[model samples]
Target: MIKNIIFDFGDVFINLDKPATVNQLSKLDSSFCVSGKMNEINEAYEKGLIATDAFVSFYKSKFPAINEASLINAWNAIILDLPEYRLSFLEQLANEKKYRLFLLSNTNELHIEHVINTCGSDTFNRFKDCFEKFYLSYEIRYRKPDPEIYKYVLSENKLNPEETLFIDDVKENTDAASALRIKTWNLKPGIDDVTMLKDQTCFG
Candidate 1:
């Protein structure tokens, strides 16, 4: 029986245009591609190994033509809408207290700031209230698909892997969780809305 539920915050909850940043950056430089040291810098930033100022400075230095605001905008373009229905569903689930609910997300500072600005503090706080534990990659200094992170969640919460269900949009992330004996739902964005989670037999 599943006693705990872990959810990915990106596509599983908030709508994200995963390719928007890449496409947007390419417009600034036709030859722009996330490569070499760029990938390293991004990983470090995501892991909270670097400060936001350093991250912005690196991009500004690389793309001198792009102003700080423009660069931040392009970087944050991937974040999109968070539907009310999904929030409602989560709230209902939380109130029921049938499962231990947690949120695990691989996110950075700028994107989180964008979410707060776009979603407003009250709305975001309500959403956050629905989870027992909220794990942000940068804050936690750990990310998904890294077994250690999953281990940390389980160990910290004293959760049994066999009694936990991990839900994420990325197959690789779900796969990693599965390796640790956790059940998972690799939800498809358009077709598998989280509001319809009850339809899945696994929840039953």
Candidate 2:
């Protein structure tokens, strides 16, 4: 029986415009789209190895033609508007108390700051209140696809791996959780909805 539900924030709950980010950056630095520098920079930033200011400054230096504001905007272009339907679904899930709910995301400071700004402080707070624990990669010093992070969450919550349902849009993250024997949902962005699980008798 799945007694715990773990969710990934981006794409699972919020949408991301991956291509737009690459396209915008490519216009400034032709290398960004071809090379994996953007992904490398983001990985470094998400792990807290690089500070937000430092990352932005580094990006600005690399792409001199683009101004700081536009560069920053492009970096944050992955973030998309939160839907009210998702919010309502989360609220309902919390109220039911049918399962222990958790949120885990590989996010950095700038992305979070922009999410707070775009979603409104009140909405962010409300969303957070729905979770028993909200785990962030930067705060936790560990990111997904790393088994240690999943183990840490399970150990911290005292949850049995078999009793947990891990939901993420990324395949690698779910693969890590499955390796630990936790049930997982590798949701397709823009196509799958997390709330659909609530209707499935197999979920809870």
Candidate 3:
């Protein structure tokens, strides 16, 4: 019956330029590579293992050419605006109270800070108020497509896997949820929008 719904934040509700960070970094340091060491640090930062200052410091130390302000700016280049229509849809869905709603996002401190700065805290809270439970990777210290994060959410909320639907823009994330018997829609960003929920077969 889909008693519960889990939604991903980036690309689902908010617009994102996924390649913007890498592109921005490359511009700062001509030899920049999103490889090995940065991947490890990035994953750790997302999981809350590393603090924000330390994160920026790592980049500054590695590149040596980029300062803290520019480095922070480059790192946050991937995040974009939260479309008003999506928020309107989410608010309508939440107000209906037909199903338990949740937000599960793999995000970091710098990006979130930028979002808050751009959107304003009150506006961000308005978006958050739509969800029954809001889970951020950095706050929870767990990120997807890890099985643990999904399991934690299911267990914490006492949600039945069969009655839950998880929507994500990433196939690997959706696949992980499906493995746990949770229904999923691997939504395509430009081709499919979250506001088209009623059109999905899972919604039936």
lDDT of each: 0.92, 0.87, 0.94
37 Cα displacement, candidate 2 (Å): 4.6
TM-score-wise, the better of 1 and 2 is 1
Q: What is the C-alpha RMSD of each candidate to the true structure, in Å?
A: 1.0, 1.6, 0.7
The order of the candidates by TM-score, greatest first, is 3, 1, 2
Model 3 agreement with the true structure over 1-204: per-residue lDDT tens digits: 889999999999989999998999888889998779989999999999999989888888898988888888888888899988999999999999999999999998888889999888988999999999999999999999999999999999999999999999999999999999999999999999999998899988
**Residue 91's lDDT in candidate 1:** 96
For 91-177, candidate 2 gives per-residue lDDT tens digits of 998999989999999999988989999999999998999999999898887899899999999999999999999999899999999
Candidate 3 lowest-lDDT run of ten: 65-74
Model 1 TM-score relative to the real fold: 0.97
- For each candidate in turn, the TM-score is 0.97, 0.93, 0.98
Alpha-carbon runs more than 4 Å astray in model 1 = none
How close to the true structure is residue 78 of candidate 2, measured as C-alpha lDDT? 87
Worst 10 residues of 2 by lDDT: 195-204
Clashes of each: 0, 0, 0
lDDT of 1: 0.92
Provide the clash count, candidate 1: 0
